[model samples]
Target: MDLHEISEKLQAGAAKAVAALVQQALDEGYPAQKILEEGLLDGMNVIGEKFKNNEIYVPEVLIAARAMNKGAEVLKPHLAAEGVKATGKVCIGTVQGDLHDIGKNLVKMMMEGKGLEVVDLGVDVAPSTYVQCAIEQNCSMICCSALLTTTMGVMADVVKAVEEAGIHDKVKIMIGGAPVTQHYCDQIGADFYAADATTAAEIAVDYCAKVANG
Candidate 1:
């Protein structure tokens, strides 16, 4: 009936309930954008905080994200009619030679949960692919994930590709994975480094907000 109820259901990971509640809210004349921001995103924000604090783990986060996605799907048509655009746009991928995708998938969900439009490039993505996608999509950030130390080097290549594409100033680069650290992020001239999916999404959202305001 109310938006808070929607948020509660999403946080509880009741996908079907969330979808029904979202539709119910829409039918009750609540604005689609308001439901998205106050209901779905609000729930996701709580999940992200819990994740950052280790109060919840990946499985819980994934479940809540699924619920949020279901709710979002129900509101898609209304969101389009209302012209409710995402807060930011980002390109996310596993860097070349890295086939790991669990982290990448988690980051994508968290980013979407934060109201950022994420373009997922799948696994083994090249530096050029990152740059090209960011440019073509008008994304403000590029997120690279690599689980292996050997693949982490490709993150630096992505930074270089962005620079060569002459979009370094227009986009921010963020890297993360088991083998990445703050030192590597700085050394490679990346804008940010996240130890996990929750942090990555939070940082990426902040960067996008700053770019939007500027």
Candidate 2:
């Protein structure tokens, strides 16, 4: 199937159909990056907008994200095998004291769909874990999500840890969650705050591009 046909199937939330179209495109000699941008990313853009508008809820979003994920999986190995690097690398976590992961997982999926290499530190991640992962992974950005007001305070601690470890200037920091606000992100020294997954992916890819060009 063609990229346009694949993207339409994705918008309709047909996971297996989309995945097969991705494989078909790859088998027909389409570049992985082309399929990614015109197909998977385009589909996610629609899904993200629907989610923001409340026209689609979590279950539907999850299914679409899962389809996008399968497409990402099929393309990833080819991109690597062909020596094509990802746009950027990121370390993402739910922050220490936050056991919930739904929000973080969504952001991670969106980031991955945008062709980012994400090192997910999982839920209940410590400040040191984030800092260490950023250092070891050479991540261009570090993302933190906290679902509760109480756990959100840990964002400052994670930022502080990055500063103390002397890697603060080396990486951009991002924060999000239900209670996270732009004001809170600025107060906690985060470089970016995303109200949703699409904005988060946009911020990450844009930041990486700015630095790479500089």
Candidate 3:
């Protein structure tokens, strides 16, 4: 079957179909990286774009992401055997005092969709914890989500902690959530602010590429 058909199936959120097609592609001697990029990530990129355009909502995006995960699961062993590695690693969590995780979870899925390895720190994450994870994981970026205004201040603390850890130059910071703003991102000395999960993932992928190229 054509790889684009796999992409179409993935975009349609046919989890079983996508998993089967991914296995078929592997059995047909398609490179795991090619299948991941052309089939799974391609479908996710479309969903991300539609989400950014507001043509799709959370439920649809979630479904597409689920399909992508299913396909990825089937392709994982092949990918590892082929020595395929993620383009970058990122640590993500909701800031301290904020237990909201729906947005954080969505961002994680979108980042994974873009083929970035994600270290999910879960909710109620402290600034120190973020710094520690970035340092230990050698992450290229730290992403913070805060749905409450009170908890958004923790993002600034994260920036401070990264600077204090002496890795500010090496680690980029991205912030998001309902109360987050570009102005606030700048105020906290963050590298990027995304209005939504789709944009957040795109910005992260682009930033990682730029960092790698440089």
Candidate 4:
């Protein structure tokens, strides 16, 4: 049976439909990994692209992500039983003193949609928290989000923390937010800077794939 319907329903933000279809696909003996990749991730990738291209907005991405989450819930146990590992692991959070979380949440959803295991540290996260979580979780990347200029400086502090922890070579750093730019990313020595959620997820996936292959 074609799993494209699962992708279509997910893109349409039909959460219950996506979940039910995922169960059906499993009952039909399709591999959980295939359903996740070809069905859920495929739909999310389209949504991400549309979001990046200005064809869709935040609300749409949120709903689609919700649908993806619903479908992923159905596949999670089966995936574990199949020994399907995540593409990569990354920790994400908003910087200290910043109560903003919408951007961080969006990046988390996009990363999850790409099959990356994300550890969300939530808003108002201290630099040391990022460093500790990366070490504890064995995360390959640390993604920092900050909407406030004052708080954005904490991202640089996170870089410093990682360097001071002596894990700079082990973990890549990605930074983004309204006030963050490639210039700021360069100035802070972050490994990647994304203009939007889609680009962030793309950068993360590419980085993780390279790390995996190497």
Candidate 5:
């Protein structure tokens, strides 16, 4: 299939078809980066939309994410062989006291598919934990997801802890999830609020690009 057709299949969550397109691009000497951007990222974006709309659940999303990651894996080694670096570096986690990660996982996949390197700190992450990861990774930004009303309160703590560490200004904070809203992000002093995974990746990438070029 052509690139657009392949991307359409990916949007429809066709894992096998995506994997095949990835292999095809590699065989034809197309740059791995191009395939990853046009094929994998584009496909996972579709899957993410399905997830946000409740049209698909975690299992299907995970499988689609796996397909996208599989494509990314193929390009990873080649990227390293050519010394290719990604556009952005981000640290992500589910806020403390919230065990839910389906949303966080979706954001992670979407970020990776968009060619950003991601460090996932996993679920139920404490405020200090998020702070520590940011310092250690020297990440460009922090993305926090909270699914429960109770845990969303901890996001402010995360912001404070990171600021205490003196990395708050160095990193832009973005917040999202089922229960998270723009007001919450503003209240917590986040740099941006993403309503869904696609917008998260887009905003994060564009924000960092502007930073990098500035």
Candidate 6:
């Protein structure tokens, strides 16, 4: 099976085709990890780059993500049987008092595209919840999003909670959203800040790689 075909169809956002192709690849005896990395993730990397360059928009990213998800569903059991592991784990949520989730959802998709297991905590998540989930899930990263200035302060509280939990050295904190900036990230002592979802995924991948190597 030409995994490249699967990658191309996935990039074109053909969910059904991607799913069918993934099954065909498995039938052809391709490794599940190969299909996941070279087919689905390869396609999503292209979409993420296009999005970051402004060559594509949200709808395109969404469709491509859907395609990736479809392919992944077909490959999931095989991947598990093969003992394929995600690059890293992260728990993400919108801060307390913030109901906006579009940005948070995008980041989750983008992270998953990069082969990171993302645990989405949904909207209006409290600071303590972020810390609790990170500890419970054994996540390497905690990502917080806030679209409102009022809610942005909650991110700082999250950082404090992580510190209070004495897991500050084990888990990294990342903050982002419409109201967030690099300065704010610095002020709040977050380990990383991304202006967009694509960048967020990249940052996560890089950090996970470093941790794995060390």
- Candidate 1 weakest ten by summed lDDT: 1-10
Q: Candidate 3's residue-wise lDDT over 5-89, tens digit each?
A: 8889988899999999999999999999999999999999998888888898889888998999999999999899999999889
Candidate 3 residue-wise lDDT at 55? 93
Top-scoring candidate (lDDT): 4
lDDT of 5 by residue, 1-214 (tens): 4666667766656767776777787788877767766777777777666777888877776777777766666677877776778888889999888999888988888787677889999998888887778788878888899988888888888888888888877888889988888988888787899998878988888977876787
Please provide TM-scores, in order, for all candidate models, with all chains considered together: 0.98, 0.92, 0.98, 0.98, 0.86, 0.98
Candidate 1, residue 95: CA error in Å?
Answer: 0.6
For model 3, what is the error of residue 12's alpha carbon versus the real structure, in angstroms, after optimal superposition?
Answer: 1.1
Report the Cα lDDT for candidate 6: 0.94
Higher-scoring candidate on TM-score, 3 or 5: 3
Worst 10 residues of 2 by lDDT: 1-10
Q: Against the unseen true structure, what C-alpha lDDT does each candidate score?
A: 0.94, 0.87, 0.94, 0.95, 0.80, 0.94
- Model 4, range 25-135, lDDT digits (tens) per residue? 999999999999999999999999999999999999999999999999999999999999999999999999999999999999999999999999999999999999999
Give the residue spans of candidate 4 off by over 4 A.
none
lDDT of 4: 0.95
Better of 2 and 4 by TM-score: 4
Winner of 3 and 4 under TM-score:
4
Q: How big is the positional error of residue 209 in model 3, measured in Å on the Cα after superposition?
A: 1.0
Q: Model 6 TM-score?
A: 0.98
Candidate 5's C-alpha runs over 4 A off are 46-60
- Writing each residue's lDDT as its tens digit, candidate 1 over 1-214 gives 7799989999999999999999999999999999999999999999999998999999999999999999999999999999989999999999999899999999999999999999999999999999999999999999999999989999999999999999999998999999899999999999999998889988998899899899
Candidate 6's residue-wise lDDT over 27-81, tens digit each?
A: 9999999999999999999999999999999998999999999999999999999
